[model samples]
Target: MVTLMRKQFIIAVIVAALLAIAVTFGVKYAQQGPTLGGDFTLTYRAESFHFAEKAKPLNILYIGYAKCPDVCPMALSHTAQAIKEASEKERSKVQMIFISVDAANDTADAVATYAEQFNPAFIGLTGTKDQIDAAIKLFGASYMIEENKKSYLGYSIAHTDRLYFLDKKGRVRDMISSPRSSEEILQKIKELL
Candidate 1:
């Protein structure tokens, strides 16, 4: 009788452990936001500034102002790190496009510089208020201007700090709501590929 009780207890513990793992992964997967898709035009700042159709499937469109204080930096850093770690084949198929939501300060040139600073392969994008607004509306991203009057020439943008992932079809596949572990993002990129 004691042996049977012990066996039952062990089985219960195993089942509980499995359930816990499932719930943890389920929550993590649920946290991912919308995917990217549909037809949209965005200006990409590369060797020379130019407009391009998002006709590709595997793409990453990161929307953040160049002057973001914390979240933007962290997200960009992690993304760069993850891409750097991706295999050559994966890296070749993936394109990272950075879009600046700050119209006042982040010019196409400035945004380009910011993204290149992280990864030269990273493509920075900026455009007129109208253009940026269109992309924001299309993606349903949010941003607010926080004026820092106390400091000398101080102001910052509080914007959604999420990485928008797009599949090869130029559709949003998934959104990484926050900075993710490098390994996890690499795995996701592989899955997307």
Candidate 2:
């Protein structure tokens, strides 16, 4: 009986040690995934916006202006369709976000409306010019603003076309540039899911 009790005690100690090691490794893995949205604050069209509130969505941040002639809208539409085509379980794990590079024209309400047209769950964000510029710089996207004194607009921005994919843990994993098929983008997003 004494020997049996000693063996059980030893087993318990081993189990405890294994659990501690697993927990440490799990934390390390999560920390190493990606650090995407850690230092940015963007204003979106929502009743009340909080990044922590939308935890279940995969948190995709797209940087473009509402006035983008082609690339931005095309990419956003593709993203929406891709999410729709995903398996129900996979689709539920994604949240597509549009961040406006043109603060002068794109508003939270405008972004929200446009995003809803594609996917109700999609989010649109806009802020001050400085805020927009800061976000663009952080993402390393390049842009050129053209001044136009016509059509009720003073200026417009033309920018590089790129889509950034962030995992559910808010880490940027990969980027998809424009001039690529939506199918290709979908395949990439599917892998991340």
Error of 2 at 25 (Å): 19
Off by over 4 Å in 2: 1-37, 46-57, 149-154
What's the CA error at residue 38 for candidate 1, in Å?
3.1
lDDT of 2 by residue, 1-193 (tens): 9999999999999999999999999999897864544345668764545446564546667787776667787888888877787788887777887877777778889977877887888888878888777766766776787887873467777786878776555556778878356677678867877
Q: What's each prediction's TM-score?
A: 0.73, 0.71
**Alpha-carbon lDDT of model 1:** 0.75
**Top-TM-score candidate index:** 1
lDDT of every predicted structure (CA atoms):
0.75, 0.74
Q: Which stretches of candidate 1 lie over 4 Å from their true place?
A: 1-36, 46-55, 151-153
Best by lDDT: 1
